[model samples]
Target chain A: MWRGLQVREQSLLSLLLPGLRSRGPRLQCQAAIRALTGGPGPGPGGLRGELDRFGGITVRLGQLRSADSVDPATFRTWLQGKCEQWRAEGRIAVWLHVPIFQSQFISPAASLGLRFHHAESDASLMTLWLGEGPSRLPGYATHQVGVAGQCPSFAQSNNFFVLFSGLIIQTKNAWKFPGGLSEPGEDIGDTATREVLEETGITSEFQALLSIRQQHGRPDAFGKSDLYIVCRLKPLSFRVSFCPHECLRCEWMALAALATAEEATPITRRVASLLLYGHREGFDKVDLTVRELPALHRGLSYKLYHRDLPELYEKMSAMD
Target chain B: MWRGLQVREQSLLSLLLPGLRSRGPRLQCQAAIRALTGGPGPGPGGLRGELDRFGGITVRLGQLRSADSVDPATFRTWLQGKCEQWRAEGRIAVWLHVPIFQSQFISPAASLGLRFHHAESDASLMTLWLGEGPSRLPGYATHQVGVAGQCPSFAQSNNFFVLFSGLIIQTKNAWKFPGGLSEPGEDIGDTATREVLEETGITSEFQALLSIRQQHGRPDAFGKSDLYIVCRLKPLSFRVSFCPHECLRCEWMALAALATAEEATPITRRVASLLLYGHREGFDKVDLTVRELPALHRGLSYKLYHRDLPELYEKMSAMD
Candidate 1:
């Protein structure tokens, strides 16, 4: 019975999938390139036709494993070409050439209603780009379509990701954290500095590599993405750049108030855990945790670690 | 100075590799999908393409951390299209399906001497396919490829992977023990059984998941690959036919002589270690060292392991 089945399946595969069952890698690469260059086209639902191929939605979980044999450069070039093609077709708006770890820079396009794109090539490499144009908005109000800042804090005591001490920017009774989009290939430290300067006009020195925040499908004022990395910073210097056009005013809120703010996003909630339970001293001696993080930092705490039976069952069954 | 360099690099990347900076998970999956399909023409000296697009090679390495995010079906579909294109253009010959953990089988083209088309897709998945056609020279005698035969002892072995073994087949008279290829989305055990039957015509009962052989690329005659999961198999039944006439003869051989046999490949050399150190008592009472294996199998006795390092390193660096 098994032999006959095997024989039949072989025959079917030959006819159905055909001559490339084994030769897929190269051909797949070509298809991806063609799709990239083929222009997303002006489709009804924006993605402009780009997301149609991918079945819409973006972002997924990533795993970390040692890749001793793979060379990163070979993969980057292929990614570069694909991105270039997208740019030529106007599928992408702006491409940032930032390093991996630097200060954060807020997205100017965020308020302008734009979605960002980041990826490695067919080979493998990091590439970040913007997709689609300004999202058509309904009206202008406190909740209207515009920039949404994402910055989470870490506890200095736990030896994990930590938040820095800096003056906060306030606009129309609303207080917000200063953060920014990263430059291509730029490290996180540099990203933080650039963001702070651009927003608060303050220069800060990074003290440590605090904690990281990651969540999937978390509802937030700005879309469903809930992941953010937190770092500790100390105000090295400060100057008030009150650009009334971009901000109403800026001031250093008390650390206690910053930690207890009512508008704390889920990201901020986790950071508050570290800040309250983790070690801290006088404002000057505030230490940020950069190591010794517990494994259950992300959704692991909610679904896996927390005894949420219903949620746990759902997660487990999805794997099945 | 560092700040200036950061800005310049970011600007260059914005112009060059857009979408190189966003922290998007879908980005990695998309890139991996692209890499799998982006058919970049061969590089200089047949050099494998580099993956660095935004941050040299580091970004590519980051991308690899998310390798599994891309669906295998997507890869399969993309490759099928390429094969059709190649077939239409008259560039491909035999297409062999070698599922992992299961035995490998070949399907001969209706006509001979057809040029097997190299997939223009990502080379990572198809590099093995390119070498799947007729083995170089020696015709039938020198290039005999058969699945390893089973030992009744595997039924009693205490290995985790073997417990699920329903489709693993082992090759016979092979210097080393090469089992079946795992299916598109199957576990290692299922792959083993399926591959073994296709190649050797045996229904193997899984016993235990043994040590992983990571040093050499793939243990089979095929090209270098990442991981090879070894399992113990027990014989249940046999079938009459083998595909493509790749194996002139296939049957059980004494496991003890596996290392010293003239027909043994480098894989056999490693198998010699398992047989010598692996606990056993004839074919019906298989016993394995239930302890977790270290990264490198230590019990194999240093002499055998050391002798193969030079050749192993050659294969390891070959991918680069």
Candidate 2:
């Protein structure tokens, strides 16, 4: 029965040939042919793909025989034709797995409306949605969270406060706040405290969220975006038993000196300055406090971090 | 050959029976039995799993016949036995797909050192890494990034600035800055502008990052954590053709009024205050600016967002 439908589609295409002489009309004719056939038919291009569960087509470019050596212009023309064909066939989405070596084709693909979905070390996945309503395709997550703890030193004299710093083994021994990536299911504060203990053997309690730095395209984060949250932590123990595998040195340094020290990372220095400002002024001016709220799901709760609410707004009914 | 190994493991267990009478030594004996057998031996519990590529084990509790009716205490004991058996077998990781209905088991499992990896509507995937060296398992991303555009209205007069807001159809008609989730690989600024245009038919350009609210356990985000960024936007065209499907109404409201409005979401109100502070004082005090920097990969760049540095620190060497 399907084969018979294909034959009928071919006959219809032949009947419409004369009217489709122009380039634009020819493309439209092919689309109509696809509509009649109920899916993409054999095209002039060699690209091949399988029908996905959603009635979409997913092409793995690296698997093609001529993928590595294919001409960009030819690929672009083929993609353009295929997109129209897929759209007419009522396909909901198009997925293209473009390998790293075929990066040259990325620009052309983007120009034709494909957007980056996510990337691995060897390949980047791009997609285009052709469905009627807004695309139902869920986006892959594009960010990783890293938490750092700024542990204030107990030994303080004059008006100066000291902070613990580690000479990290990973970055040419530059001094930085002791921290690490947040493990799955770990809260920001929990991660900060855990990392501080693991890297410098310091026991601390989470005080408040001080600042956040967001960066994209980090190689260490598997090419995903990164969010680094710096939390202020109050120290419970001052002893330093630094992990030799992760840090070259760890010590307490004056906040003012560390803020200006050439050895510290730019983020560290900037955060130090912010900390100084908070110390001189009030912490409420800079801290983003965390609140635990009941989640929509029964028996579960979620953490919300934002600037502390003023007394007037604190009494307002909670927003969902 | 496998049967022979199992028999030998049983014989070994029998030989160690005297010492294994104690609880501590019983676990040790089971571990030894597993080491000799090269896999988990038949245990007293009914729980089962398949070995993954990395010598890990994955169990889908939802697929079990008795999953929906299992007793929490009994399940905990069974899980404890299974964990010991798997750990003895030198399994690298253990994955459990706990259905929402079986949530009572979550606390027990968590007490046994399992952590949440990710969640879907029907179930939450939890994991435990038992092998040496920090768990080689990759963590599932726990965040969804949402970008909202705080468009400064053109109707602003006097010293007070007006902001565009929509009565969101999804949130009890509460007023909110126009926004949506960031598409995979889209910049925060791009998402803000795109969302503003899509929701209000108002063309805008991203100006600066104003504030961020991080909340965990959002159900609409497939049970992932959420990061909501508010971007200050400069409107290009202000004629609002509000999307009826998304908003009940759209209008420009005075910043002062919106800042204290009870109809706005808590986050919206908080951001309004931040924006008002920026307006009265200096935006430099509140805005986190974006900078494009070279990525580790050739021919790629990443955006970094942080507070603008003071003049003294602005000239410092860029930290990787």
Candidate 3:
């Protein structure tokens, strides 16, 4: 129905009547979608359930990544899940706000990779689109709420994330990293490290590339970006340095503790996400899976035997 | 006539003849092009004579910076004179053996502000289409021949030109810039610097954007890229650093100073151009007109003379 809507922009009720009679029953799909997301009710819930039953998850990821790839059931299911999760988490109980769409748009000159999209209604359970080469893949757009995991080890477990106290530029009498506009031909990593050193007086090393995240519904903004690749850096020395032109203050934040004042405008909840995700997930091993593994691996007697199988990776890659 | 030739595959000659005749004295423009590029032998050297009358000459500068911006010819006579000096010095004579057509080509992104077209004729000059930006301003793509100037303050006094050694990346027993495939949301600059550091173990500060240039007409292959951006960096603590996975050796060199034992590959030439241009012209102040001014006074002169100077600054800002 959504596919037809994108193309013809027709009413869903019109397309459903014929299929309603011949296609057994779609009421289950509608029910599932609704169960996942309480609002916009039953029709969507059933649609979600029906789509999941068919196992067309990849199609949904595509819708978020490209406009051309559409999967009504997948979108419905993802949206429902997000709604349910948010509601259960109490945010929905307060205001019932919906998360919009999100995308990781890229230049064709770049390499081939998967594109994901999150439905505006469901911020989680991003729709994934797979493709090779420069051809545009299908995905969704609008905005999306970023999902960042927080872990305890990132805060105080190591000194790798700290730098010298006096080594940052002071803006309004505070020490901080110096990051501004990206110069022509500069890369993100270049931007990050340069900003840090220029604003604060410390040379640092970029340790690892971490997560790509998005910002949604910024109070002053409209569109949300897809994941931004985050990195971990360790400062080499303590140096009281300041570039009066770029920043007012730079200081070290304990991985375990954060100083939340209006002074740190841009580096808010996001830093916490970066630290926690970087530590707990091992930075490089963040698992972004598409579906729950087969239940037999956990509930059945065969599960024990399956644990020893070596063909798992090969089979998973083949994805029949 | 040249524009007609330019639309070779489209039968534009037949379709636009009436339009051309009605528009202006295109024949004059055709004659002008041929004479400037030394096409058709009896090309009358109209462009050459203009330069001669102005004491300027046109000499071809071969594969240097992959990308560059040509400033508006302010003192056309001086421009011609500069070319004449180079040709007189034998610096421009290298083209005789270089097979003018075997060069790479690059197109400026609309962001950089330049454009070119494939010439109808197979000859190098005829093959290049250069034009000034504003519609009233005419521009032509020429095979540039650069003359070296004396810089006593620097180490070598060749006064002709010097290229940098750092541009070439040698690692993992193979040589390739830290540059690789542009990932989604990446551009040429992002690729260039990343590739440099990835391949070489040194990171530099991006100081200024230099030029956007292109090579043209390679009998054996399609043209590659010439991205020119000026950057400053501290040299490595040691010269033997290698990335076993990406490269085996990385070193800097002055092209003229390179010995037979330190020869470079074809791609190395592309990087050489950037180094040459940066060292000679000063990347931040790329516009030749600015280079012509006394180093201290050019800033004020640039601010006062350029058209829509504010807009130009804005354009530069966007790239930043």
Candidate 4:
């Protein structure tokens, strides 16, 4: 009881005397710049706790963990409770800056009209309007898009492109595609091609669409979803350069080798087989209409076209 | 000469009579829907041509191979040739749909006013306003953002998380984080927690942050760049139930075991060591201003935080 009173007394004194809030002597430093919330007047720097701005409180969310009952409903309820508490505190808006990878809370936050405000270098800003009179609430949709390339082997080698981060580092035994996540406003195809080039330093051309897979219920996904697009690409150059920051080395592995490489990811082998050998068994194809021939390959005068697999087969068979 | 003449005659006939272009009968099926570009226009079903909308001709790009020189200047020259050809063909707006992975052409395309047009499910639309008086080409900045989680070991088991996509598929021998790419607008912290939950079905709480890394000159980046944020997370629930579609299984791995695991990525090993043993050798701590804890941790909150290290130190000191 005495400790509780002491805590309350200290808070009361701190609240009444802002200058006396610090337990230690204030250090001499240059004036701190305003946190770019861009609304309301500037405030002091390095001040712990909520900063009142834009008629709301900017919350610094600690690293979030699932509450004991880590289900979707409970998580949402927890988020709702936080909003309610903020509302009761007479805040007009609740601005939360979350890291850009938290997909689980997006939907729940969206439900509360705390939509995406903008993106920083590493985090996304979300704001929930708490004021009563017709606040502007925008609809937002979030998705995890994993962009990877089927860096196919050259026609002669029949090998697919792969990169080894190194035998001494994180991916010692595993080989990965020169692909990663698509950036904001970047095309998925561009992601695949860039990743391959970045990892292999081999400029590749995007070819046919191989397959797109969507899976949900990932732990990191927070019950959201992920979309992965795998493209069939042809290597135009055989340069073996690579960015050391991203990978240690690049190689053109035979299809047979990739299929059996103990270090290859499950998805990599499947893609090599599908793109190189035309083995599209378990996955469905997305029918795309393209200029009968690719722009670079237009010299061959391949007529532009689009067709389902069955129709395409029929046309070839008819010629035969 | 007879065969060549006959082929020429057939081509001439087909060019003149568009209806008779197909050598075989056209497939009698319901008219196909336009590819779900989520834009204006009802195009002819399965017509092998660019979709005409927004006063532009959507281009189908081919698998690009760099010529022997394989420089950006050369690639740009080749692209310029294609653009010139299209200009001659009277295309006003050249709408090229580059995949997200096509980093090689990004700078060159951006320079040609083939800026970001819009996005579809799998690709980004770049519009090169070739026709008309001063077409509005908006500049777009593209980045590949990767969110990884550093799931810290709980008190009982200094066991970091390691997920297996299963023993059968491509990820047969590999272990991965409970994290992947963050969905659009998702917070990086949320990404760490959510991914852990999605892959492991263990609800984790965001703890202190670990690190943020930015890298440039990635091959797939095509001179663009990527930002990766690795977070320190605390698992709330240990019961890990994962979706079969996402992973084979997840296990809590001891820090020491992970440091030596051949398949573990170098980054993963370093992270495990740092989190478990405060191993800060040969790497700089990314300056992330979260709670002052990390900065203090830099200055021996490091000592206050770890009991094992202290006990070991005390034993060594006593021996001394």
Which residue pairs collide in model 2, if any? none
lDDT value, residue A201 of candidate 1 = 72
Task: Tell me the tens digit of each residue's lDDT in model 3 across A170-266.
Answer: 4664323344433323333455567666666666664433233223223312222222233345566545375665654545554323323333322
lDDT of 2 by residue, A19-55 (tens): 5434455567657665443345443335666688768
TM-score of 3: 0.22
DockQ of each two-chain model: 0.01, 0.07, 0.01, 0.02
TM-score of chain B of each: 0.34, 0.58, 0.29, 0.43
- Stretches off by above 4 angstroms in model 3 are A1-177, A180-191, A214-228, A255-267, A273-320, B1-320
Evaluated at residue B34, the lDDT of candidate 1 is 36
> Candidate 4 residues A107-169, lDDT tens each?
455566665554323344567778788653322223445666655554344344343211111
Per residue, candidate 2 scores C-alpha lDDT tens digits across B101-177 of: 55456656777777666543334567889999887776655577888988765465365654433222234457788
**Decreasing lDDT order of the candidates:** 2, 4, 1, 3
Give the DockQ-based CAPRI class for model 1. Answer: incorrect
Share of true Cα-Cα contacts across chains kept by each model:
0.00, 0.14, 0.00, 0.02
Highest lDDT: which candidate?
2
Over 4 Å off, model 2: A1-130, A154-173, A260-263, A280-285, A292-302, A308-320, B1-134, B154-173, B260-262, B282-285, B291-302, B307-320
Interface RMSD of each: 27.7, 13.1, 26.9, 22.6
Model 4 spans with C-alpha error above 4 angstroms: A1-141, A155-170, A215-225, A279-320, B1-320
TM-score of predicted structure 1, chain A: 0.35
